[model samples]
Target: MLENLGNRFQDIFKKVRGHGKLSEENIKEALKEVKMSLLEADVNYKVVKDFIKKIQEKAIGTEVLKGINPGQQFIKIVNDELVELLGGTNSRLTKGVKNPTVIMLAGLQGAGKTTFAAKLAARLRKEGETPYLVAADVYRPAAMKQLEVLAKQINIPAYIDEGNKDPIDISKKAFGQARANNYSYMIIDTAGRLHIDEHLMDELGDIKKAVRPQEILLVVDAMIGQDAVNLAKNFNDKLSIDGIVLTKFDGDTRGGAALSIKSVVGKPIKFVGVGEKIADLELFHPERLASRILGMGDVVSLVEKAQEVVDEKDIKSLEEKIKTQQFDLNDFLKQLQTIKKMGPLGSILKMIPGMNSDLGDLAPAEKEMKKTEAIIQSMTLQERKKPDILKASRKIRIAKGSGTDVSDINKLLKQFSQMKNMMKMLSSGKMPNLGGGMPMGIGRGKNKFF
Candidate 1:
């Protein structure tokens, strides 16, 4: 998401670390580059200026210059500042003391507000919260229907009134229905307009008064960069939005909006839309994002994602197989499915430390994974458990089935053997150093075949 900005910082650090001892002049030169980088990222001019000033004030001080690993210390200073600029911490939704805490989502017409409502509902349901969807957007074409369809997909009940035209009445009725049905949470998707106006603001105000939403979330498109900041400001001016939901965070924006909105609009970003999938909305963590922007991947988040998709029973079984050195193609395919369920392969890889800018590596690694999965799936049950049974003759058959060649089959078999041996070492508390994400027998050096 912050690919451009990340590369710039990574480059600057490369230069910083290259020097044995950095002088004040050297640090100033680097911050100059940093200033240009932040400015080019479309960050608010004042935020950038203040951010750079804060870093420079600390970066050249005697405390850092004389510290061990001064260059790394300087980088840490910059990272810390970035975190502060990005909201410093997460802001969670406040649970109402009363039943059915209402959360009203407001955004521009095409900002994906309706879809995010369903996503939030799904998240709440996953967490044992009985969240109901209120399709109060009666103005847009098919907006309420879209919400109903999403609610159905997630098996959550939605409050929709085809006969009701006033959003205020629809919201009020929905709140009453939530109480009647014992819903703990209610996400009301308010109607959006092409642009802010008195009419739209008045409607939103009326609905807000009717429901007294616990969280008034302003959804903004991340692809618009600083323009999103301006939009957020206007919404906050009228409604004093409690937080922000930056949609299309996985898009090709320079990440300026995410870095600037809190400073401009004075509301923490509560969630970010990482992908189009309903499961893609993530609770915003500013520190994790700051680490990501500095090319230091978020391993904690990666583990959390894996935990979400990996079943405990399956994990125990997989552990047994790995410990016994009996992992088979079946186990491998199951692991691939586990990874897929977590998220996109590329996105998952980016969460690993030092892999944020490894898109070049991930593309081919993903391709190899898919090809390996295909070849393994084509094999018979016997061949999967005992690869030695796959003689030259069987290799040809598997190649034909998988639309691959015998040579491809041979390479996969060899890699699987190496991986098995590697697993044995890992199980015995021995780890082969995989310099730079080159997993055992997977990249360069020994087993670069894959």
Candidate 2:
């Protein structure tokens, strides 16, 4: 979603680079471009106006830092303002001091309330908290069953009183069950309803009063653009929500909701549903998102993602293989499998500095990874461990089995050999440019498309 915005910023900065000392005209023209870019991104017009005003105020009289051009100085100013406009800091979900903390989720229909509840539970479960899902969404067909299935997949307990149609009754029983079972927290998945539905609002109000939840979160669909801002306002006005959970955050939405919700609703977005997987929810960090929007990669989020899915045993084994100079096709395939778990390769690379826009334009990263994996899988065990023994005849057989030409195999071998050599140098304490060595089409400085 930020791809276009990043490209726009890059273009504007290139134009700014043509100037030695930025004049008032130069600043005005650049700010005009920035304003247009923000408007095109679906940001609130008032927010854009104020954002541009601040940037112009700071950019007009700012002295360029030593060794930095006016373009870079302007980028810094924009980055700072973007950070502030994006909430200036991370808003973490607060854990209740009392055990069995009740957290109720409320939102409009089709806003992913049930799904976000399960995602939140799965995330909390990963953090060693005993989270239980409460299926109080009695209105939606199969909503309870849906929550049950998701909980079963993650091995988390779920409370579903399918016989009871009253959401209030279900919520009361779920809380008791959670407390009786010694659970740390209970996430109540309430029924979704539009803000205009007074009957549904009364039902939600009854549930809130009965449960007295410590946290009332609103699950919002981020794809609705400007309507998301209005939805948040209405929900906040009625429920006085503690924070927000944005679903479909990884979609191709214009990102106006994320940029506008906080300012319009005065509520921080606590978490974002980044993917469809149960483990794909992420804590929302305003500063990191601002950085990504400005074409700077979010290294912090990348590291956090790595920590979540990385296996210590696999890391140790891979290190041993690298240190012994025995890393081969099998290890390479294993590495690809790990990357797959880390989410899409394109999404991952976008988090690395200077690699913001390489994936989509340069190559199909996910397909390349899959193709590489298939090629590796087709090779015999001996061939994977010892590629030197593969002669021309064997290459032909392997190529046929892997559904590729001999050239693909040869290219893979060449890249593998280069990677092995680079690993050897790194083991001996030499830092080299990774841009030329990345497996997929990920690059930074003057590298060809993979």
- Candidate that would win on lDDT: 1
Q: After superposing candidate 1, which stretches have Cα over 4 Å from the reference?
A: 18-23, 64-68, 361-363, 428-441, 444-450
Give TM per candidate.
0.94, 0.93
lDDT of 2 by residue, 47-86 (tens): 8988888888888867777798989888888999988887
Question: Per-residue lDDT for 249 in model 2?
Answer: 90
Roughly what TM-score does model 2 have, to 2 decimal places? 0.93
Per-model C-alpha lDDT, please? 0.86, 0.83
Clashes (candidate 2): 0
Best by TM-score: 1
